[model samples]
Every structure is written in structure tokens, then in C-alpha cells.
Target: MRTAAVIGTGLIGTSVALALTRRGVTVYLDDADTTAAATAEAMGAGSMAAPESPVELAVLAVPPAHIGSVLARVQGRGLAHAYTDVASVKARPHHEIQSAGADPAGYIGGHPLAGGERSGPLAASADLFEGRLWVLTPSAHTERLVLNRALELVSLCSGVPVIMDTVAHDRAVALTSHAPHLIATIMAARLENAADESVRVSGQGLRDVIRIAAGDPSLWRDILDANADAVADVLDTYAADLGGAVTALRALGSADETRRKQAGADLDDLLRRGNRGMHAWCGNRARRPPVFCRCP
Candidate 1:
């Protein structure tokens, strides 16, 4: 596409605009938050207003909750010839467009699986989506032109496009993204009452585990609510594993050598399986953890 409009100049939106602008595409920016959009423009990301006429594509990079309504209004107004969104969840918005009687032919559902524990235009980077997965969910009524435009946008943003049905995309993200964020929040919440000694002894392991807890709670709440059923399924499975861990830990406190050994072995097996699973997911073998030693 020669020109594109990014409708939410927050982090993802600004990053997308930056990527598009860098690649010589004329980008027009629009957001309810004028300051955010202007800031993105001043940073050379794109223009601070939508073009007078319909652009090649309009990317609605708003939160999942705002996507459907925003897209409906924009598309209704003929803001762009084709449209897509960068919301985390897809199914809800896809249904929303159909229910609202918006032209599904002009739009596709998109989600770039890349973000940081940060927010706003200032946090945006042109390379935010680099080497990351971008999912496109095109319904039966979706036009090929719109789907191609979405894929082109993903390519310009340095993302790898993976096309899947809306339902599959939502469920996959619930397991790999949403559920993990919930776990991180839970882990970090426990640290609120941690003793001074406990906090003082914090290591990289704790830091890695709770990194996502730094994300905006309000955003996460909306995302979790949107895909509650899928997220709940993941949480239920995690709860079962947690229960097993608790039972094993209690058994370790007993005097019985058999129980203690069994618990230790069980924990070891779990960790090994986790390592293998992660390695397989990344298509790589496990590497040794970095060792730090002080000279005496």
C-alpha cells in the first residue's frame, strides 16, 4: 500500500507507523488522545491526522475492547479503502463487525505477538515487531485484497505472518500469552507481603518469572475478560499442576524418606519436561544457565 492510517498512536500504533514510514509509505495518524498522536508525528512516525481521502489501508491499533466500535465508525465513514486491527484478541472483534453490519470485506483481524512491559507512544520502536509472529484471521467473507493488504503491512513491519481462524488464534494466545500474564501477576502479587530477607535474596529467576507483571493491569484485565473461557481453561490446567506441587512440597516436610524422595523426583521430572517442551517450542536444545563466579 502507498499510504496507511494508524488509528491509535499508542505504542503498537506508533511502532507500526514508524515501521511503515521508514519503508517509504505515507502514514497518517489519528487517535482520541491528540497529544499521543502528535507526539508520534513529531517523532517522525507519521502525520497526526487521517488523510482527507481513503488511504490504501487503515490499521486500528487500539485495545481489544475499543476495536469493534472504532473499526465500525472508521469503516462506516470510509476512513480507508481497507482496514485491519492489531488487537490481541480476534474472535470478539470479528463477530462485532458482522453484528454491527460493517463491511467484513474491507477488514481482517490481525494480532502481532510482540510487546513489552511498557506503554504509550514514547515506548514505541520501529523494530517492535521484528522477528515476532503476526496472526491474520480472515473470515469467509473477507476480501482477498484486504487480506493481502494486512499481510503486506505485517511484512513492512518486519513480522512473520501466520494465518489462522479467529477461534484458533484466540485459544493459542490464551495458552501462550494470556495465561502466562496471569501467572506472572499472581507471582508478583505474592511478593507484596514478602519479608525483607526474601526480597533481598531475589535473583534472576524471580525477575524472569514476574517480568510480565509490570504490564498495565487495566489492559490485561480487558484482555482476560475478552477471552475468559480460553484463559480459564489454561488457568484450570495450571491450578492442577500447582495443586500437585503443593502436595509434593508438603510431602517433603514429612519424615518418610520414600515420600520425600518421590516428591523430589516428581519435581525434577516436571522441570525436565518443562525444559524439553520449551526447547521444542523454540526449536532449539537447552543451553546451560550463565554462571557467575567471584574471584577470591
Candidate 2:
């Protein structure tokens, strides 16, 4: 696309604008908070002023809750030829937009599976989406032009495009992103009441597990709200696993020899399963011959 408008000047929006601008696309910037628009403009993302004419595409980078209404309003104003949103939740917003009487032909739903523990235009980077999966969800009513525009946007941002049904996309993120986010939060929340001595001995392991817990709670709440059912389903399974671990731990205190042996086996099984899962995620390189540490 030759030109585009980014309708929210937050981290994702600014990052997308920066990427498109770097690719020589004329980007128009706007946000409900004018300062955010100005901030993005100052960062060389795009012009803060209104575009003279409708751009080739418009990206609604608002929160999941606002996407439907924001899209409806922008399209109502003839803002662009085609539109897409970067909201993490897809199915709900897609259906909501349709329910709001917005034209689905001109819109496509998208989510870039990349970000940091930061928000706003200042935290945005042109490379935020590099090598990351960006999901596209187009329904039967979606127009080819809208889908193509979104694909171009993803390509310009150096993102890998994966097309999925809206519902599948929601479920996928619940397993891979949403559920994990809440897990991290729960782990991190433990630190809130932790004694200073305990927290003082923090290690990389804790940091790694709780990294995403630093994300804005308000934003995460909206995301969780949108995909509550899927997230709850994931959490239910996780709780079962946690209960198994607890049972194994309590069994470690059993007076019976058989019970103690069974507990050891259970713990070993869980650890081995975790190792296998990690190896699966790490792919072929994990199976390669390992080089031992050579430090003398």
C-alpha cells in the first residue's frame, strides 16, 4: 500500500507506523489522546495532522474493547479504502463490528504475536514485529483487497503471516499467550508479599518466568475478558497439573515406602515431560551433539 493511517499511537500502533514509514509508505497518525499522536510524530513515525484524502488502508491499533466502535467510526468517516485491526482478540471484535453494522468487506482482523513489557509510543520500535507471527483472520464477508492490504502491512513490518479462522486464532492465543501471561502474573504476585530477604536472592529463573507479568494490568484485563472462556479452559488444565504436583509433593512426606517411591517417580515423570516439551520447542538444534563447556 502506498499510504496508510494508524488510528492509535500506542506501542503497537507506533511500531507499525514506524515500519510502514521506513518502507516509504506515507503514514497518517491519529489517536484519542492527541499527545500520543504528537509523540509518535516526533519519533518520525508519521504526520500527526489529518490526511488530505482517504489512505489506502487504516490500521485500528486500539484495545480489543474499542476496536469495533473505533473501526465503525473511522470507516463511517470514509477514512480509508480498507481497514484492519491489531487487537489481540479477534473473534469477539470481528463479530462485534458486524453487529455494529460495520461493513465486513473492507475489514480484516489481525494480531501480531510480539511485544515487550512496555506501552505507549515511546516504547515502540520499528523492529518489534520482526520474525514474529502475525495472525490474519478473514471471514467469508471479507474482501480480497482488505486481506491483501493487511498482508502487505505484515510484510512491511517484517512479520510472518499465518491465516486462521477468527475463533481458532482466539483459542490459539489463549493457549500460547493469554494463559501464559496469567501464569506469569500469578507467579509474580507471590513476590508482592515476599520478604525482602527472599526477594533479594532472586535469580534469572524467577525473572524469566515473571517477565510478562510486567505488562499493563488494564490492557491484559481487557484481553483476558475477551477470551475468558478459552483462557479459563487452559487454566483448568493447568490447575489439574498443578494439583498433581501438589499431590506428589505431599506424597514425598508419606511414611510408607511404596508411597515415597511413587512420589519420586511422579516428580521424575513431570520433570522429564518438561524436558521433552522444551526439547520439542527448541527443535533440531536441541537434538544435535552438545559441545561441553571448555572454561578451565
In order, what lDDT does every prediction score?
A: 0.89, 0.91
Segments of candidate 1 deviating more than 4 angstroms = 284-296
Task: Predict model 1's lDDT versus the native.
Answer: 0.89
- The TM-score that candidate 2 achieves is 0.95
What are the root-mean-square deviations of the candidates from the true structure over C-alphas?
A: 4.0, 3.4
Tens digits of lDDT, candidate 2, 1-296? 89999999999999999999999999999998999999999999999878889999999999999988888899999999999999999989998998887899999999998885799999999999998889999999899989999999999999999999998988988987999999999999999999999999989889989999999999999999999999999999999989999999999999999999999999999998887766655553323433432211
- Candidate 2's error at 98, in angstroms? 0.7
Candidate 1 global TM-score: 0.93
Candidate 1 per-residue C-alpha lDDT over 1-296 given as tens digits, one digit per residue, 9 for 90 to 100: 79999999889999999999999999999989999998999999988755878899999988888877888898878888899998899899898887777889989999998886899999999999997889999999889999999999999998989899999999999998999999999999998999989888989889999999999988898899899999999999999888988888899888999999999988888888887766565553123323432112
Q: Give the number of colliding residue pairs in candidate 2.
A: 0
Find the candidate with the highest lDDT and give its number. 2
